[model samples]
Target: MTKAERALETRERILKAACEVIADIGFENVSMRKVAEHAGVSKALLHYHFDTREKLFAEAMTHSFAQTGTDLDGGDADVPAGVLLARIVRTMLPTDEELRQDWKLWQELWVRAQRDDAARHLAVDLYDQLHAWVGGAVERGVASGEFAPCDVAAISTLILALCDGLGIRVMLADPRVDLSTAQSTIWSAIAPSLGISPAFPET
Candidate 1:
């Protein structure tokens, strides 16, 4: 491959390694050297790509989210909006191993954001992206007449907050709150507002 391609590959490797390291251990315990070792690159090369641990952490967290492939637009037009929204809600939870790891990274960011200004900003920016995606789905549902006209922004915030609360329980292996229960609870709470059934869509 060309030099640029190689560089891009290395950068991606480092970011993936960073995500794994930070998720395995707490972010506070991770070092650039540790990430470099995990990525099978020299410390100098890691530094060349990301000058600081904070920068690396930010990018790693963003990378982890992007890996989910959750998009804001252009799903199967034939799919009902409720089904599409249900799919998006399911994706936000730690239903599988990869999502579990991604959730761990999010937990790390939550802890770091409490004290680190940069991390705080990153958290807000990431939330904004999530909000846009969820809100867009809600708007689409309304426009398609599959959902009742309501406050889209408020509904989006409520859905996200519910997911955050229930997702933590699922991640912690709370027997009372399995993935299905969490999903159903969210659907039940919001379905009335959207004029849809409380049942979680099979999709």
Candidate 2:
């Protein structure tokens, strides 16, 4: 690979390793040395890319969030907006191993945010990004006349809150709350507001 490509790859490896280390342990326990070792890179290289633990944590969290969903925006244009929305919702849940790891990292962030100002800001920023992502789909559906014109912001916030609540239950292995049930519950609550069927769209 070219020098730029190699550099990018190394950065990605370090960030991913940081996510796994932080999730496996907690933010308070994560160190630059630990992350460098996990990434199979030298400590100097890790420091070169991320000068501080805070910076590493921030980038790692952002990287983890970016990997949560499929590229819905690049998906088939012919798919209904509702289906795309469903797919987005599904991505937020701990439905697979990678997503489950992402959820664990989120859990770590939530705990850290309770006491750390920087973590709290990062948490809010990440949530804002998530809100915009969900809101974009809702706005598109309304513009296409596929969904009822309602408060897009309110609907998006509700969807994200519902997902967070149900996702925690699924991650905890709550006997009554499986992935399918959590999905149905969300769809049942918001479908009416969007003028879509309560049945979860097959995504």
Best by TM-score: 1
Q: Provide the global lDDT of candidate 1 against the true structure.
A: 0.92
Off by over 4 Å in 2: none
Model 2 sits at a Cα RMSD from the real structure of: 1.3
> What value does the lDDT take at residue 18 in candidate 1?
98
TM-score of each: 0.96, 0.95
Model 1: weakest 10-residue lDDT segment is 69-78
User: Global lDDT of each model?
Assistant: 0.92, 0.92
Please state the error at residue 191 of candidate 1 in Å. Answer: 0.2
What TM-score, to 2 decimals, does candidate 2 have? 0.95
